[model samples]
Target: MTLPTSTLDLYWLPEAVEFSTAVTALRAAAAKGADGNADAGAAAGTARMLANQRLDFLQTRTLDRAVQGLPDAAWGAELTLAVLGTGTLEHLLPAIRVAGLRRGLRVRCWQAPYGQWRQQILDPAADLHRQRPDVILLAVDPAELLPDLPLSATAEEADTALAARAEEMVGLWRTARERTGAVILQQLMPLAEPPAFGHFERLVPAAPGALAARLDEALVRAAARERVLLLDLGRSLAEIGRRSVGDARLWHHAKQAISPAAAPWYGEQVGRVLASLRGLSRKVLVLDLDNTLWGGVIGDDGLGGIVLGQGSAAGEAFVAFQRHLRQLSRRGVILAVSSKNSPAVAEAVFREHPDMVLTRSDIAAFEANWEDKPAALRRIARDLELGIDSLVFFDDNPVERDLMRRSLPAVAVPEVPDAPELYGQTLADAGYFEPVAFTADDAGRTRQYQANAERRQGQAAATDMDSFLRDLDMVLAVEPVTPVTLARVTQLINKTNQFNLTTRRYTEPEVRDLRDSPDVLTFAARLKDRFGDNGIIAVVIGRRVEDGRTLDLDSWLMSCRVLGRGVEQALLSVVAASAARRGVERLVGHYRPTARNGMVRDFYPGLGFTALPASAEDQGWSLDLRTAVLPQPRHFTLALSV
Candidate 1:
């Protein structure tokens, strides 16, 4: 047989050329004509091909290394990714693994496939006790594959079957989750037109006009009932037509098979999806003021002349972008501004702009000065008492963005979309802000910040701690683990670290099991003051032993927002009162130290609990209920109705 000739040509060849060079060497071996050994040329060519391929692999691997080295300031403290199963398991598996490698994650990926209506996904998850991933990405496109499932003959029948299937799937996931473990992330289908897989065509076989609407509704309901994270990639993808193989809009697969130019963009789309899922747990959205949120430099635009509304195209774009951010803020995204501008000018624009969607009250904190953007961001995080890793920084200047990207390394610095009009679309597509539900407490976040600012200002005026506490009009709501606060409590039990005594994270299923079991007691806290309400911000889990006579504080935590405001004291007091009422004679306070939880190292000791010397570590403490003082501070208008 004649030998295959070397006709290979490739761009972006690594330090050592792969296919091309290997083919060339093979061709050269053939030309040499090893007559004595007939297989000599073939052997040489095979060896050359292997070497080149290895080199090519090494080059691609280098890229991953570079990504791993990305500073914490670039993406946040840790990478928390929610893997959505687009039913594109073949396509997503590699990408998810890539995103997970070496990334600091609290929970790993959540996988949901459309073919089995989550059954396929659940079977694997049920056995995930040992390999507990931080978060689950239910990235299945139900619109694409659900039609292949067994559908009921009638529309009502179909709806019932689908709902039941969804409920069962969610139930399995809930069962699989450990106490204070695994966040469930569901990515909604981004709308793509026909010519590709035509998922839109199949969105609703039963209803034509409301197909997309119905799917969205199903997803929303499924997410809520399952207590899963919902990233709105659909809203953004709907605006920009989804690229499909049929349309040939995105040559992702072909490019991967061919070149690197196509590689980055294709990888970027996947990365964008992953980034959105990862950012769900991100605590802070740090923004740049000049040119990022508004058009023109505030110092140069003189505040009044700065373009920010409908009259101009750029201004309208910014207005729309700000509205998108406002939507995020209303969904519990903490907003902070870090701008290199005079506070006077920045404050004026916010005050004067009639069409401006954001206000001074909307921002959690504002760092306005000549400080470097990265430094300003660090300060913003410190002032807000959030981790630098919890920050997602957005800036217009490439230099500043790059500076922070390299130095801080942990913050998520999404590459800015080239055009101004695409800012909202790009950000939406990026999927960084996914929230399950917008509660009343979320809507009042800005007002809460304003209240905090007022309280801080009032601090200087107060002569004593009692007078300061009395002036704020703080209200504390203490209750048992009810359905309304269960979601928040579970979230705290899993995510809260610094103020967590015992550092015990509970899963929803575990919490539910606790509620059912007679031996366990769980409680949640809600605090509202002259500033506003912080809904279900604290949680505590306890177990009763010796016939309801003794209580062990299994898990206790409070959100840092209400940290300094005496919320912790109030929560513990309520727990103590409840335990006393339950006829318990003793209360136990537990502490377990973690790398980040040094803040709570002395929590039990500070709470006046006697330390137990049973273990070398300060693992346990106890207080006699009869003698323990109930810290019922008069400043808090406390009412317990549980």
Candidate 2:
């Protein structure tokens, strides 16, 4: 029997080509390929463009088939997500799934009973509690949030009502956290169009617009909690424009708060939040120099000849792009240069050019040699101690961009618009570097890596390993898991690939559960040296097993920056002592091999553990406390806490 064709087969089409002749040919091919046998790239490109043009084009059947066709492993990570909203959100699911697929996430979405916001959260036995999600998105509409407010209400009444509603909202978030331990993504109330008071809306403090602003402020304060993230749907709506984003007729007929036209925009914002949670956020922005940073080639144009700064229109555009890059640098995104120009020539532009906003100091690494860009990018990744996948490369040359995309599929190589003026907005729209939480560590990460390089250079110059270790003046501070360090600990567990024994990943709630459990001991290791502080370099999670006689190491990982600085030994010593204090007679360790963690395959056995044969794929090792002792590092001044 011939089965009906599915739209899922068209999801892999290539984007539109520029040539009119090519477009005509592709359009003909697309028509002929409608039977699911067309060129996969062309079909995918057609489907994506159509989906963008009209969200209704993304059929539920297509999404279901696309999801089911994905291999179990294609769901790189599972994110159990629950959505609670005042209006119908069933129409938004397909868009959300499309966004999730783009980010390599499998989003299992659960929708709350319609308009049951308060009951679903307040009732302990609600289905939301039974299905513990990793993330909860609260999408209550503005009208529902301020249901008691009247247009003619007095200022005092409005103020009181807003305060009470804000309190209730925050309390619900706290209650949800206390019950389910899921991270909350709260959507700020959307701004209403055509203000109730017309031109006098700002004059009336009790007006709907004024009230919405007050509620937004309150939500911002509530979002300071570690597990809470604010999704700026109001801002997204404003950017997407109200004329197309909100449909009054749809709301009146179907209670759909957002128009189908705006579902894709909403889904992108939600997907970014999910990506940040899974640590898929891009860390580095590798930029090309010629025509990318300035109006012309640095090698040929010289420092004084390049079109940069404020005089010409083209020059101002480049400056605007540079200003944007500088803003990104301030917010913890590492920037680097990868160009095929002479190192001296490129250095002169950054060092001497008055129009340059990004100096040499702003870049984490600069590679301006005459080598293949793919090789240069790999070198930059190695020097920065980051995964190639964590990079986003931008080059003005199509050849260079295509080479990067083909050679390194993992790195995001965004197409640069022909005009330099569009560079800033193009990069902003890409949303490759979205962050979940901007910690002090993030702000100082580039400086930290630079300091690490200095430390490495010092280590190489030392006469002996012992001399190098002593010169580092390293200090290892070990502390039991606490609320203050819990976030970083969870981040390390998810992101640290190399030097990770067992390579286990955990969510924030799981980390908290382990920290609070009596049978488990978790500790975070912070290291400092003559150069600077490497915050939370290592973490050890152990569980008391065999009736408390054994301490089984569930996870042990260290930052690559402190790999050879004796921090690992210091961390293990503290763990062993803590176990001994708890009356543990033996220490058990396991190593799970992965493509990235082969460096740590022999980590347990090298630490004086005997191999224990097990049927499981993970290799097991054990150390008898009676016969084993913790090896103290001679260089580190250690402080241990139980």
Candidate 3:
């Protein structure tokens, strides 16, 4: 349970000496735990323990070897990722696989021969065309793409070359995306080249460094324009330093753009993005009060005596950490407080402290009690209407952190620092809230949660469920999936689980196509109550089938916070009306159960859809458009904008 306080521990993972023994135990435990035994749980813990380590290349391979062949039951989600680049990608595969294991994914990878990425992408006969990849990472190195412009060339010449290269890459991305129906990821060229111009590197427009820099910026813009995820390898390279990640001898001997030694770090960078796409990224930040956020326990030290805010170094460090949390809140990362102190005493500091950066309102949930840390975290997730896995626990006490890690392997418990000064840096380094796209809903996340709290209070006060919903004036805005709502729609498509039917995920580009498609009936539902607005809470997609008489419900998911508020009733009503208007005779609803989406197992049957023939626990329900009389929304005033 010793927290890493210095760079000396960088070479090994926690308990590295016993890693091989642990792996052997893990294999035995996996088999023994399968027959209704506790061995599976032990194997999982061992896997998580080994997977979260900063291992050497060989250790990563060993972990990957053990986990890769496991059943889909062991992994949260499965996806095939194709890594194509101009350099030696074979060395990076083990890291990617191990990284996927860390992030709760079973990533199967495919690579083009040596450097035949272009032909693999362009020619239908290539092996890439035969495989259906969920994600494609174009790891094309800048050395292969960026031209060798002379030092005397003008800035305009550099701009022209950058534009051409950006277009070429974008074209490749579009072609690959079309061929594979996969999400595209573009890797930025790392700052591998030391400044040839040294101090004058910034002054020369035609220098190799200048073109590479320009190309990096160009690729970033292109990625944004095309909705491609940019793996900023350069940022990680800068952090790790090219001197460590780059090997000159290997580059000269073979076209190894990046060295094998850098695989662990490189894998982490790639894994973060790949995991994020599947809505596996954490959503909430739970902070401990005593000695974690500030210098002392407020229950004993009192507000004035506590060391926080300005003045002393310890006080300033806590303030800096709070400031970081506030910034995260502004970006839609939900904040919560879990403390072992009296609720009134802990909240008084937030309300009255003049130098407090995070006010009580900034936190979505505040759980202050004498309960154990595990139970406290569960209550926090329940209050937020999020799964236990969506929570990230931060505590300075090493014992509490260890207990949390062992108890909830799904929840992210980062290796925090013992010192107050390093708190913010450690949390930021964990990458728990890695975001791919920021929507309007994200910016106003705190307000939305606070509003939900008010709604919950309203429900508690009312005599009945019907009366409570009626008392709160709710507005359900049903809109067609337009460009404005595409980001939020795609976000909900991935992150939502509890109420999601089918649990199908789509990238932004694919969502855009659905928005523009004539055959798809897409609805993005937003709810607003008397308290405030709940930004884009639900998304439902209905696709026309070959039968032409039925509109198959392709996906239905909602934010769990808005579950009991009757949003589904109004949304389904609108869908029924829209489908009937399109001359469809029936609506087919599917419920493809996942581990996290069991809450809505009987959703279709509950809504009056007749049961149809099902396969392998997946139920199919059909509603006759000709004979069905769908219920009108009772609780909310509905606006159908589509």
Query: Pick by TM-score: which candidate is best?
Result: 3
TM-scores for candidates 1 onward, in order: 0.32, 0.35, 0.36
* Candidate 3, pairs of clashing residues: 33-40
Candidate 3 lands at a TM-score of 0.36
Misplaced by over 4 Å in model 2 are 1-240, 445-642
RMSD in order of candidates: 27.2, 29.4, 28.3
Q: Which candidate number has the best lDDT?
A: 3
- CA-RMSD of model 3: 28.3
Residue by residue across 1-642, what tens digits does model 3's lDDT show? 122334333455564668888888787777676654655655766787798887777888887777643555666777999988875778889888877777777789998766557667766666897889999998888866664343444578667766766776787788889889999988886644333333334555655567788888888888898999988978864654554566678799986767787787677767876777899889999999889888887887777568775335787788777866875776678899888988989999888864577889898889999988899899889988999999999998889999998998888998777788887767655677776665556645445434433343323223334655785679898888765466567877878777898999999899989878888989888887654455578888999986567899989888765655667878888989888888888999999989988879889988899999899757899999789888888988887786
- In model 1, the runs with Cα more than 4 Å from the true position are 1-464, 616-618
Clashing pairs in 2: 12-44, 13-41, 13-44, 13-45, 14-41
Query: What lDDT does the true structure give each of the candidates?
Result: 0.60, 0.73, 0.76
Per-residue lDDT, model 2, residue 450, is 48
Write one digit per residue (lDDT tens) for candidate 2, span 105-191: 667888886545656777687789988988889987776565233333456766666776676677788888788889999987565
Winner on lDDT between 1 and 2 is 2
